[model samples]
Target: MGIFDKIKEKLSHEFIDIIEWLDYTDDTICHRFERYQNEIKNNAKLIVREGQTAVFINEGQLADVFKPGTYTLSTQNLPILTTLKGWKYGFDSPFKAEVYFVNTHLFTDEKWGTKNPITLNDERFGLVEIRAFGSYAFKINDAGKFIVDIVGTDNNFTNFEINEHLKSLIATRFTDTVGEAKLPIELYAANTTELSETCKEVMQPEFNSVGISLEKFFIENVSMPEDLKKEIFEYSRLDKIDLDKLTKFKTAKAIEAAATNEGGTAGAGMGMGMGFVLAQQMGGMMAPQMGGQQQAPMQQVNTMPPPMPQAIQYFYSANGQQAGPVAFEQLKALFANRTVNKDSLIWKQGMTNWSPLLEVEELKAFLGGNTPPPLPGS
Candidate 1:
């Protein structure tokens, strides 16, 4: 070959060598090449199977190399590196990568926690406590909106953030749906399971935008107002008042029975007094018949004459001397008929013994001016 041709061939070979060197040094010298490689690796996406996960590795970064299974991406594995120096010398891994969705069911069961199921009775005022853990199955159905408006492409999303958003979404949708349902407050207070189901049904469409399938949901617990609970308790025990009134009525009836028994005893005493008066009247009628009968067989009979009428002796107030005669028969008759109350004495100690002072006739005669002298101080 001629010297000019040799020189041209040599220039061509040198140019090819420079191109190969540029390709080799692209990771360090070309920002576009580095970004392109990063995009390719990061976008190495996979559809997360029901029981599996997917992991994405950066081309050259210090990172933990994962097994071939899918894994949920977390903050623990971030900032995928795309340079040889970062892979070899940096504390971080060259294979900076993202772990895709992991099947949480592998590590947890229904007991771990579950989504609350919706029912047909949830209301606006109702509250429910829901329990769930780990990342849930979701997809960015509206990729463009999710990347641009909902969550920026540069932003790293987390399960906690997703859960919070989900909670807010659920609450808002539940409130709207409950308002539309126009359910009674009583239903909201009483039916928690129904409320949860209704909430799920109402929230399904809203969650669809975020690609959450709402696998299952339940109302772990419900909290109600204390005053409402107290009202319910009072209503349930309403019979207590009636029972108290009945007890009082029974006690009153028992007291009335006791009073009736005492009154009956008093009536019996009155009846006995009436019987005695009746007997006295009947005896007076029989006395005349006995007086008319006489024995005709009398031979030598010794008969006693009627007793002489006794005189009542009185004493003078000045000397306490026996002073005058009073008819004892009249006084005795006055006492027996109760026309004179002999027991009504005004005598004091050191005075004379009890003695009759006035008969009923004496009282009448004194009033008619058949006077006796006023004695002593009188």
Candidate 2:
């Protein structure tokens, strides 16, 4: 039997007092009231709750849209339906029409993600592949158009029917937006806000055309393949680290480790082995230069560095302003010029606090002529 006939058969003895969708489902985006089989009584109360809207459709034609409020199904209130029905005066009889309730609230936390990796050409890594996942929100802006285009005349339109289509649409838009952007994959996480805004701008027109509004789009994470991520990480680490410094530190640590061993065969003895290897290499190289002469004494090849003199520097403070770590010669000039006096505070590498120059043994000679200046408070 037809839908109307089935409803008529079920409600043959009685009639609906109120025409409204009282209980709505979470998954259902729109619901066509099952009163198709029964006639809508004149002056029937139509309740449109908050975040909801009621659309009246007459025999394959869209009529008036009722926002969130109590609507009285009268000829005066429904001028479009009344005109379509060709009612000269207000008819008090029942009428046949379809009513659909649309959910217009912002649906939040809806997930959108890539199932497989999306490959992009990267400047640093050549061809790179990445996957992104995030949440989005939307609302029904045009209820009549949504009913006409998406929900249609179905008894109920739920998320199950539209989930795949929405996901596919979002993915297509994202792919287009990302491809056109040519953004580096590594920057996706950092540039999520900009990317999300761009995606929304690119997708709004298409969504609006279908009676829905793309409210908010967000990208939470963009990840590459495990191997690719590891490679990128290693590349970043290698780029930031100084190879020369690393080599020097490792060599110094190796030398320190060797010195810590007390065994007679370790430490500087390893230097003898290294010296022997170096002498063999040197002999091989010098043999060509020596023109077959008898081998020279290997003891002459021992390479030891000469020790360097220790440098002593002094720092002085005058008038609350501290001065540099000057060498001994500069200190002598400063004392000769009287830039520093006998009581001027001076300090050096091993000293605790700044001491008067007269009290320091090193400065006595530079003081010149006559008895030494008395120490302060001595």
Candidate topping lDDT:
2
Give per-residue CA lDDT, model 2, range 1-378, as digits (tens).
899998887776345668778654677789888874668888888899998999999988999999999977888899999999999899898888888998888788889998777878888888887888898888899999988888877888876676677778888888888888987666777898999999999989988987999899999888878887787776677767765433323333344454455356665664453344334445555868898677767867668787545457678775677765555645555565566789999999888887999888878777664676699999
Q: What would the C-alpha RMSD of candidate 2 be, to one decimal place?
A: 20.0
- Write candidate 1's Cα lDDT for 1-378 as tens digits: 999999997545432111001122211111111222221232232233333222332332223333334433323333343343243333421223322222222111122123453333334335433222222233334332332334333323444445557655655565555456666544545565676677677666676664445655554544445675565465556667564333333333333443455467654543443344334434545779877988578687759788644333222221233321212332222333343453332232244564344433333342334666699997
Q: Candidate 2 lDDT (Cα, whole model)?
A: 0.77
Clashing pairs in 2: 4-37
Q: All predictions: root-mean-square deviation over Cα? A: 31.2, 20.0
Q: List candidate 2 segments past 4 Å from native.
A: 1-14, 237-239, 243-378
CA displacement after TM-score superposition, residue 370 of candidate 2 (Å): 77
RMSD of 1: 31.2
Residue 260 CA error for candidate 1 (Å)?
A: 36
